[model samples]
Target: MEVPKKEDVINEMREILGNNDYIVQVVNTDNEVVNLLDQESGELQLEATANIFIGGSILDRGITIKNILCFFYGRNPKNFQQDTVLQHARMYGARKKEDMAVTRFHTSSAIYHILSRMNELDNQLREWFLQGNDQSDLNAVFVGYDKNIKPCAMQKIKVSDALTLKKQQRVLPVGMWTGSKTATKKMMAEIDHLVNESMCGQKLDADGFFYMNKDVAQQIIALIEDTYVYDEKYGNIDHKSDMRELLCALEYCTERSGGKLRAMVRTDRNMTRIRANGGFIDSPEDGRTDLKPARERALHEPVLMLLRQNGQKEETEYGNIGWNNAPFYWPVLLTQEDLAPVMFALDQRRKGKQLTIDLTEMLEGVNPDEVLKLSYAGNPIDQFGKEGTTYANAEEAAVETRWLKESVASLFIEKDEQGNWKHNPAVPFDEKNDHGVYSLNHGHFPFVLRDYKYILLRNGRNANAPLMLLELFPKDEWIIDPRGDFDEENNLLDDNGQDILLYGSDVIYDKNMNKTNFEDKSITLWYIEYPVKRVVKYKCLKK
Candidate 1:
């Protein structure tokens, strides 16, 4: 920030350009709008003299740099939301890979992790895109882990869709299928023989589990790749490559590293697919949210049955079900930066403010800290998002974020058959009219939130940040006019915390929240932890 250091930076940039004549300049809000432009031509004026420019977070997004060869970004936020971090990737469209040295991204290790995760997310979304899926289409997609570190809320997959979720539970693969068909035939003929030799007559699991030494597992994976077919419409070669790579790496981590790879094979097809509110595939995330391709499926078949949990009824058969009673995990997970917002909320709640979480609906046999599934089976160490509801520390999210500030402003409202402003009865309202008023009684679904983000992200209307924005809402008396109707002036009725935010929207979205209890009536916000982070982290890296 010092002038002399800035001069040195400019001078170094000039040396890089081999042009002493290049102009160096400092631009900021102090400069008028016209100062950023060439008044004569009305074009964006380039600070050509000084090729190096220094500023803060304000310039992080929106501007395009066509010839930027080097980007040095040092400012890192206390919390790193993926979307915000990706915005600083100003070097996106740079095409000269050979000249990548000229076009480089310089940031800290923490920032690099965020950028890497963003890229992983983009790639996963790309795979879904190739399936002819778009943001507007409702699909049982895995976007990312919610703060509970679970697969974010998904459009509950229809049982009729025949899309069953197959999760490997509480175990690692002993040996990936990599042997030649002849070898596979040989191996299958005497799986016991192969394991007996490796384990001295001991099976990893009584349920037909067997062990294969690292060398044998490696051979099997190589063979699987050599033999796996990629001809099916839903089977992508990339997915196959990913599976083989995963098995190979797992072998390296467990078997090759002199540890046994524990695995189990189940014949039970009665397993229920437990979709967390904002849940995804279970632990050891491996980054692949899509179902295993046919090529890989041939080796590890899905055995979980698709069903709404017992004691829970569908509004319509196979229709979307409320997530409150679905499942839950404990001790909510949050980004490190989210601590402040969570603490802020706790402090406010201490004043007897209604920061309540809905706990009305109970999935039988479910409780906090213990992961619950429909079967009431003990929580698997490897699974996540099987829990009921999870909360996010939205306080860490910046209040100035466009999506956070404008979410209610942009809700898409659909009309019922009667043509009334068919409001979602779930949101609170005044007795006089369906006057929208902010209240703690409201509970939200993760899918709807992600849907908005998905649409906005596609059209460049969103920042692709975490959906943890609601916590930024002021805990005490920050009334937001949900009806979104304001005077022509778009007036602010008050300057205090009770200010009425007058807003109107082109589309009215169906907004609803989790119901705490029918008898309790009032809503209070509460956060409980969930162990779902691994399921997200595992599937990110590519071979």
Candidate 2:
């Protein structure tokens, strides 16, 4: 394959951006040709303005470009490291609201999908950190299993862990024959009773789809192994193991989606066999599509589709292909894409398969016996306890730690008039529910308005909390006063001297905390704005 020259790419970019206010600079390791830095102090000597740098790996990692309104990443390696791919995300970090609106990111669909999944995984890891999970405690890092992509180099991750199916992935049985006619008939009858009798109200939809709870879905999955038989004579996927993994993925999704999933029994399909005596190949609907599935309009839910094929072999136009005369249900599980990557913790030591650490490779030239032991800075018993600091009890230590973590609400971030991001002192707010207290600020902060129901509880203390905090739901009479402004003492008030409060409703309250009859209230919040639309285009690259 012929690689395009850097000069050609630069010239093309120059032609496209021609004579604009933007400045274009080519930055690479070839400093001899185009020098932009001082030799003595290593400081950038270029003019201070909006500049676009055309370079390869040089723009990655530690490189920082302020106000990066546009980013075009096309680097595609044969293999990808999770860290290396993430570090190339130079567009991350603080930016002014105006610049952020025009910010654009261009990449291939494959790369875009990979980055989106990685972003979800990264967010999960961040939540764990925010809940005070130590690095050592985070033993399992869930990564989508791709032959080209790895979590990192094997040497980087010292431990060996078993891989599991990633979230939002589709799993279906491939290359399999059906069970005996006697067995399948019994299985079908059982399925009929289970769906119609056991699950009555949740009947089959108008489109042949049946919405079932998590337990019912599990029951349907259990019937697959008995009805669809994966012959041992042929090299086929392990039915038991695959079913278990599919169930795991289902459990993860259903738990988040209110224990609901739509199942469809797709029957009378003429799916031909792969080879003589081999199981029938999958249909197009068996695979996942970017479009949302039926019954469950929520994009963040799972779908279970069962294929009931005509179990009879005949001389077809293609060849003598089809399953045996035993109609069976082949399960295809489509997982939810919006959830965090599913990871399972497996203790290899418990199974007598411990991965021994090679000290020679790890320490290199250092003597293993003479290696000094480094202790944790904090007390081993208490996570929040620091060295030389004493607490009366564990409760006291926890309280102090919670206070320190919540201290960030004391200030809010906003952009100054010069289009620079800055922090301002925030007015304090404290609200308590069954699951401890939630502190918010009275100053403007960046926010993305989303449906309240789908929001996952990330706080550790609220791990077992309900999806919706009932008390926080807005009341009918509660309305925010649009004309309300903070007084000299930081107390929000309207023009008529009614105190503005957002605790229960958006309406103004009296000194005794009773809502007034002012129906002309409007919604007001110290909230941030986001762009209404985002455009992502795909690039089809040829070898």
Indicate which candidate wins on lDDT. 2
TM per candidate comes to 0.29, 0.35
Residue pairs with backbone atoms closer than 3 Å in model 2 (clashes) = 479-506, 479-507, 480-506, 480-522
Q: Largest TM-score belongs to which candidate?
A: 2
After superposition, which runs of candidate 1 have C-alpha atoms over 4 Å from their true positions? 1-23, 30-34, 40-44, 47-49, 94-101, 132-138, 144-543
Runs with alpha carbons beyond 4 Å of true place in candidate 2: 1-149, 154-169, 203-205, 237-241, 268-270, 275-280, 284-298, 315-320, 336-543
**lDDT digits (tens) for residues 238-332 of candidate 1:** 23333332332342234222444333222212212233322312322112321222113213221111111121223423222222222111100
Tens digit of per-residue lDDT, candidate 2, span 368-454: 333322212111223222223333432233221111111132222233566333332352222221111121323222221222211
lDDT of 1 at 450: 13
The superposed Cα distance between candidate 2 and the true structure at residue 150, in angstroms, equals 4.0
